[model samples]
Structure formats: C-alpha cells, structure tokens
Target: MAERTRQNNGNGKHVWRGIVIAILAVIVLAAFISSRKGEVPVRVDHVTKQDLITTISTNGKVEPMENFEAHAPAPTTVRKIYVREGQRVRQGELLMQLDDADARAQAARALAQTKAAEADQHAIQSGGTQEEVLNTRSELVKAQAERDSAQKNYDAVQKLAQTGAAAPAEVREAASRLTAAQAQLKVLQDKQQDRYSRPEVNRVEAQVEQARASYTAAQDLLKHSEIRAPFEGTVYSIPIKQGEYVQQGELLIQLANLRRVQVRAFVDEPELGKLAVNQPVTVSWDALPGKIWRGEISQMPYTITTYGTRNVGQVLCAVDNEDSRLLPNINVTVNVSIANKKDVVTIAREALHEDENGRYVYVIRNGHLERQTVEAGIANNTRIEIMNGVQPGEVIALNSMNAGTPLRPGLEVRAR
Candidate 1:
C-alpha cells in the first residue's frame, strides 16, 4: 500500500507541475499578443500649404517726427503769451513775450549813442563842421585880398622906378613886402585845407563802429525777449504763465509737427537678431481704441540695452500720422513681421522635434509611425514652415498616450 501511495504522489506532483507550466506558457503568450495588438492614441495634423507670417511682438513708444522745445531767454517776467496749448501756429509767429522795458530802453540809448558817434566820425573825415568850413573860407578870402594889395603896390613901385619917380631902394622894399604877403597867404590856405590826416579819421570811425555793434546786440536781445515759433506746428506744452518770473533756460513751451510720428520698439535681446530694416510694422495704442498705425522698421540698434525690467535692443519705425491722433510719449503695441512665406508646406510647432540629425517629425500612415527628417524655414509661435522632406497632406503625429508612449518607427498609432 505504501509503494502505491508513493507512485500516486509522484504522478500528482508531475501533473500539478505540468499544469502550472502550461498556465505560465499561456500567460506569456497572452502578454505578447496584447503588446503587439495595442495602439498608441495620438494627436495628429495634416501638412498643408498656407501663408505663414512670422512676427515678433513687443512694446514701443510713440514720439513725434519733429519735436521743438523752447526755453526762457532771460531772467525776466513773462509779459504775454500769444498761443495756448493745442494751438497750431505758422513759422515765425510770435508765441510769447517777456518784460522788455529794460531791453527797449537800452536799445534807445544805444541808438542815440550810435548816431552821436557817427556824427563825430563824419566831421573828422570831412576835416571840420559847417561852421569851421565857413571860417576857413573867410580866412582864405582875407589872405587873398592882402596878397593882391601887396602885389599891386610892388608893381606900381617898379613902374615908378622905371619912370624915375621912385627910388631903387623903395622898389626893392616893396617887392620884399609882396613876397612876404604871398608866403603868409600860402601858410593860411594850408591851415584851412579841407583834408584831415587818415589816422584821426579812422580813430573816430572805430568809435562809430563800436557804438553800432552795441546797438545791433541790444536790438537782438529785445527781439529774443519775444519768443517765436521755429516751424509750422502745434504747441503742445506751456510751462510759464503770463506775469510769471522765470530764469534763463527755463522750460517755456513744447511744440511738434504731428504730421508723422516715430515708434521706438523695445525688443527682447533674444529676439533682436530677427529684426531688420524696412520690415513691416504694426502699432496700436490703448488710448486710441480701434485705430491701427502702420509703419516699417527704419532703424535698428547696433547693441543691446536695458528697458525697464528687460534687456532689449531698440528699433525705430516711422508711422503716418496725418490726422495728428497719435501723440508724443504714448505707449503702444508693436508687431514686427520678421519673416514670411507664400504657399508652403507647414505644420504646427508642437509636431516638430529636434535631434542630432537636425529637425524631424513623425508621419502617421497605414496605422504606423514613420520617422521623417525635414528642413525647416521660418517659424512663428504656433506654426512652422517645412522646407522639405515632408509632402503636403501627410498626417503628422503630435502626441501619444500609451505603453509605448512616444512616436517611433513602425509603432502602431491611431489618431484621435
């Protein structure tokens, strides 16, 4: 009986072991089948030909194309202001005036002095005044009379001597008297000549010139007391009131030509490399609501700088402001179209990936994932331009949620 029991136990053990091995074989086979049969659920997209416009957005500042700032010319009181803020004015229009009583008085004094100096110069250049000329003429007449009388006496004495009526010694004395009278007449005429030395005239003329220069300077200072518009524009600021005392170089007024405006864009340093000259730009301001301003990049910064809390590079653009709606120093949104493409194959940026071989994407076809290497061009925040390696209308796998978990070659996928 013991031998029979032992044989039965061995049989039972072999039977149980065989059953367990068979069950384990079945489990392994089921696991393999499930692994091969399962599909990865993924987000997918169809590559399409579309226009892609790549842009970089940033904040910008609005400024006038031409700005003018006026300052006080002297430490004086403001007498009058002709134009108010927001008033349009023509070039050279009188804008304001300071108390010019002192300047005007100084100008009058300078004018009087200039005239006096000019008169003195003229008298010296002309040798003498009218009265002195008349006196010289009288002296010339008297000397001429004396010379004529003495000559007549000498002639008469010579005639008498020839006729034997006057002694020879008396004739000689008469001739000597005539000679002395002629010499005296010549000396008187020389003293009374109209010509004066050049040095004396030039000295007086220098005084006249100095006085004239002073008069000109005084006139200029008086004119400067009244401010004038430097160009045709609108006055936007006035810091001084009438009858207010102001110092020299104080702020007086601010003006600008609002026909056109400029925008200064502060771009992040990372995006600065994408900026270029003449790129199309769009600007909008919160204050103006629905209005859009159009422009193009006119200037770009050569180096990076700091703006507020960010390191940025500056870019300048010009906007048309014919209606003068956009004001100076206003904040606005700036969009720069850095790159663009016409009709081209594109995919969402999320569908693209990069590896050592460069950029790539997974194409889903026939329930399998196909790895594709591609050349990419311009890309914006949401879309990427596929330059090559992927055809239009190909399905691209974006995401997967399964055991395999990611896009892989020959992996089974089902797009949702």
Candidate 2:
C-alpha cells in the first residue's frame, strides 16, 4: 500500500513538471517569433523627377458661330413655304410667302390714285395751253356781257317802279336776276385770278403728293408679304406650315451659319488668368473618335456663372469646319496645355505627401528611407513638379513604412 501511494505521488510530480516545461517552451517560442518580426524588412518604391507639361481638361459643347431666328414681320396667313429644315439657303432666297391679296388690292388702288395725281401734277406744272387760255378769256367775256345786260334791265325796272308802270314783284324779280349775274361774274373773276397767279397748280400739286405717299406705304406692306432669308445659312427649324396664321414677330424658323463651328467651354477661374486670345486648343468629340479638331480662343465671356459644379468662366473657341459636317450642341472634350517646361524635375504625384507644414516626399538614401520636405509647382493628375528639396535620379518611397520596424535614414530596403 505504501509503495502504490508513493508511485501515484511520483506520477503527479512528473505531470506537473511536464506541464511547466510545455509552458516555458511556448513562451520561448513566442519571444523568438517577436524577435524575427522585428528583423523583417519593409517593401518600398523609388521615384525620380522628370520634365512634364501641365494640362487642364474640361467638358465643352460644340456650337455654331452665328444663329438667327426668323420671325414674321406682320400678321398674315402663310401662303407658301419654300424650304424645309436642314435645307441650305442663300441670302435673299425666298423662304416663305404670306397671303397678300388684300395688300395687293390696296397697292393697286394706291398706284392708280398715284398715277392720276401724277397726271394732274404734270398738267399743273405745264400750265394751260395758249388755246385753252384764250378759251377761258372768251368765257369771261361772255359772263361780263350777261352781267351788263342784267344790270341795264335792273336799272330800267327801278325807274319804271318809281313811275308806277312796273309792279313791285316784277321789280324785285329783276333785281334777283341781276344779283345772280353779278355772283356769276365774281366767280369768273376769281378763276381768272387763280390761273394768272398759278395758285390752282399749287393746290393740284399738294393733292398729288398726298396720293404718292399712300402709294408708297401700300407698296411697302406688299413687299413684307414675301419673306426672304437675311443671310446665307442652313435652315435648322421651321415652325409654321402653309395656311397657318401667324402674329407679327412670331418665330418662323431658325437659321444657323455653319461655315465655322464654335465651342463653348468653361475654364476654371484660376486657369482663366493663364489663357489668352489665340491660344491653340485641341478638341475631341466622342462621336468622332481619334479625330482631333484644332481651334483657338476667339472670345471670353465677361460675366462669370456660379451655378455649375465648379464655378468657372466661359470661353468661346472658333474651329474651322470646311466640311460643314460639325453641327451645334455636340459634346466635346477639350485639352488645353496651360504650361510646358523642358528638362524640369518632376515626380509621380503618388510619391508626394502633405501635412500642416506643407508639401513633402519620402526619399531613400544609403538604403535608408526618410521623409524630406519639398516645394512643388504645376502639378497634374499623374505627375508633380518638384521645385526644390528633391533631385533627379533620387529614389523616393511611395508609401508609408512601419514605424515600429527598424526603418531609418540608412536602413536597407527591398522594393516590392
């Protein structure tokens, strides 16, 4: 019994010892792993500066250089429509015509009146012929003779009434006749005075002028019935149809001059300051891939719009479209080279880092990676200009290294 108890105690002691040894082994193994982790080298990359040309990209739209809206000059019904949308037209080409029946009638009436007035005016200016003048004189003589005979009869009747040989009624009737004859003689005298003074010609000339003015107004209204293109262009839209009633100044069609296309692009305000007139620009359209259309800055909007995703100034560029296939409102991409430098030091943009202090970069020296502050300028999406604190052919770390690891200014590293 004593031997068995002693054996069990011995076995318990051995098990405890084994447990302690296993625990010690685990601790030592963990310590070894920690030491190995500390010695693991971090992976990094290098960067070097090179010359880069800075560029700005923006979305723009293609537009026509000139657009015109045709409108009805007066209220009328359309009689004829001569052109369709997209039809090429020349200046002075008849686009449409309005019903001009009333206008024509008015013009005809006015023209006849004008002709009559003109004839009267000519007669007045050329005065009466010698034969006509003589005839007028003869009529005046006859009127004078009639007046004298009536006066003689009136005087004789008055004398007879004083002698009671003529009735009072008869004497009154004779006096009325003499008064009528004297009135007639006065009218003849006035007519003679006008003819000699040419006053009648002046009155006729005034009548003729009034008729001529009416005629001219009627002709002008008639001309308005025929609508003509004001300039050479393509018809973009036609809103009215034949027999459609249109009010004055109503839009009829849209005409656009497509000889040259204009692109309207919004440039960043910061970039606008660098742009100038005649700056060369490259334009691309998704509709026509691999084709680059050349253009130049033609105009810049004086006003700035604050409503877009980015507040920018509007600029207009004129592109030569000899083929005339380029139309308005096409989506376009514009790449403008704002600045270019030759043989200048530049670095990949990813290699640069910044904090509150300013711009900086990670540089490797003697196998050690260190953060070096840098001055940057004219950076683009892919690259940045290293103005200072960085040299050409110097390797720079692209990402942050583990601080707890043994990374220092002179530590060796393998790029991954």
Candidate 3:
C-alpha cells in the first residue's frame, strides 16, 4: 500500500509542471502575434503647391516718427499745466508753464548790464566821457587866455624896456610866465588826443560782447520756460505736478505725432543678413491682444550692438497708426517677412527631417511609408518649400500617433 501511494504522487507532480509550462507558452505566442500585426496610426499631410512666406521674429518698441521732448531750462517751479497727459494738441499750443519770474528778472538784469557795458565802450572809443571832455575844453580855453595875457604883458614889457621905463629883470619874468602858460596848454591838448590806449579799447569791447551774450542766453531761457507744442501731437508724458520744483535739464513733458510711428526692432546678429529695406513687417503689442500693425523696414542697421545677452542690430520700421492706438515706448513683437514664394510644392516643417545624408521626408505611396531624399528651399514657421524629391498631392507623415514609436520606411500606417 505504501509503494503504490509513492508512485501516484510522483505522476501527479509531473502532470502539474507540464500544464504550467503549456499556459506560459500560449501567452508568449499571443503577445508576439499582436505586436507583429499592429498598425502605427500617424498624423499625415498632403504636399501641395501654395504660397509660402519666410519670416523672422524678434522684440521691438513703438516710437513716433516725429517726436518732441521738453526739459527744465532753469531751476524753477512748475507754474501751470495747460494740457493733461494724452491730450491732443495743435502746433504752437501751450502745454505747460514754469515759474518764469526768476528768468525774467535775470533777463532784465542782463539787459541792464549790457547797456552799461555799451556806454563804457562808447566812452572809451570817444576818448572821454561828456563831462570830462567839457572840463578839458574849459581848461584849454583858460590856458590859452593865460598864454595870450602873458604874451601881451611880455610885449608891453619889451616896449617899456626899449622906452627905458621898465627893468630887464621884469621883462625876463614876463617871458617866463608866457612859457609856463604855453606848456600848460600843450599838456591839456595831448591829454584830450590820447585818453585811452588800444588795449583799453579792446578790453571794453570784449566786455560788451560778453554782456550781450549773457542777455541773449537769459532771453532764451525765459522763452523756453513757457513750453509749447513744436508740432501737432499727443502729449504722452508729464513728469512733474503743477506746483513741483524741478532742476535744470530735468524731464518736464514729452509729445509725439500718433498718426505715424516707427518700430525699432532688435534682431540678433546672426539674423541681420536676412534683413533689407522695404521688407514687410508686422508688429503686435502684448497690451492689446489680437491687434496687428503692418509696416515696412525704413532703415537697416549699420552696426551691431549688445542687447541684453544677445548681439543684435537695430532695424527701423515705419508703421501707420492713423487711429492713434499705438503709443510711444511700448514693447512689442516684430516679424520681418524676408521672402515669399508663390505656388510652390510645400510640406509641413515637421515632415522634413535632416541627417548625415542631408534632408529627407517619408512619403506615403500605395498605402506604405517610403523614405525619399529631398532638396529644400526657403521655409517658414509652419511650412517648408520642397524643390525636388517630393511632388504635389503626395502624402507625408508628420508624426507618429503613439509617442516614441519610430517612423521607419516600409512600416504599415493608417491616418489617425
């Protein structure tokens, strides 16, 4: 009875092991069949002939084509503000006014100084002042009269001496008086003739010029204290309150014509070569969504400069803002259209692949994916121009439906 029981247990162990092995073999075969027969659903596109435009995008700023800025001409207080921010003003309209009392006082003082300097210059040129000239004339007349009197007395003394009525010593004293009077008269005449030297005249003239220049500058400051619009524009900025004190050269107001504007685009140095004058450009501001402003390149950069972390060139684009929506100094995005090709064979950019052998695309022909080497031309953000190897109406794989599934030639695929 014990031997029979042992024999039965051994048979049962063998049977159970065989059954487990059979079940595992069936699962492995089923997995292999499923993988082999699975079809990779992919996104596909049809190659077609259409217009394609190539563009490059970069950051920019909106600025007025005609702009004006005013600063404090002298240290003063803001007297009044005629226009508020965002006010539309005509040319020559008053915008703001500074406390011009000090400027006027300075101008008046300068004018007085100029007048005084001019009087001094005139006096120097004319040899002497009116009073001094009159005094000298009076002295000349007195000296002449004394000389004549002394001469007459000397003549009388000579006659008396000849007539033996006067002594020789008296006649000699009369001659000495005449000589002294004549010397005094000669000194007065010389003094009138050369009252000032050449250097003295030059010095006075220079002072007159300096005073005149100072007066002119003072007048200019006074005029600038009353700010006026240089052209028809919109006032965009006023940095001070009506009663605020400001220093010379401090920013006061800013204005610009909102009818026309320019966008200054900062393009990276590598993309500078693709830029040219008259190229179409589009600008969009983040502050105003869904609004686009169109323009053209007005000026090209002559030199490259560092902008943030990029070496960039500044390109100017002229835009029309007739509605006056775009404001100055606003940040915006710019797209420059470099090239436009019409009616050309094109494909989605994702369908074009590049490798060591150059550019290629997988085309769907007769219900199977076929890899074809391609020659490409210009490309834009979403599409690429295929010069050859890919024809119109051919379907190409954009991407695999299952992520990470490799796109291979001869793989069976169906559009998702």
For residue 99, give model 2's deviation from the true position in Å.
4.4
Candidate 1 clashes between residue pairs 3 or more apart in a chain or in different chains: none
lDDT for model 2: 0.79
* lDDT tens digits, residue span 209-249, model 1: 99999899889879889888889988888987988999989
**lDDT tens digits, residue span 1-416, model 3:** 99999999999999999999999999999998786567788899999999999999999999888999999998999999999999899999999999999999999999999999999988876668999989989999999999999999999999999989999999999999999999999999887888888898889999999999999999999999999999999999888899999999999999999988999999999998889999999988888899998999999999999999999999999998887889998999999999999999999999999999899999887667899999999999989999999889989998888786789899788776
lDDT ranking, best first: 3, 1, 2
- The local lDDT score (0 to 100) that residue 416 gets in candidate 3 is 65
> Best candidate, lDDT-wise?
3
Model 1 misplaced regions, further than 4 Å: 1-49, 55-61, 89-94, 143-199, 228-231, 264-279, 285-291, 297-316, 330-334, 364-369, 391-416
Error of 2 at 102 (Å): 4.5
Q: How many residue pairs clash (N, CA or C atoms closer than 3 angstroms) in each of the candidate models, in the order given?
A: 0, 6, 0
By lDDT, is 1 or 2 better?
1
**Per-prediction RMSD in angstroms?**
9.7, 11.3, 9.4
TM-score of each: 0.68, 0.59, 0.82
Q: Which segments of candidate 2 are over 4 A away from where they belong?
A: 1-51, 55-63, 77-83, 89-103, 116-232, 267-270, 284-291, 303-312, 329-335, 342-344, 354-358, 364-368, 373-375, 387-395, 398-416
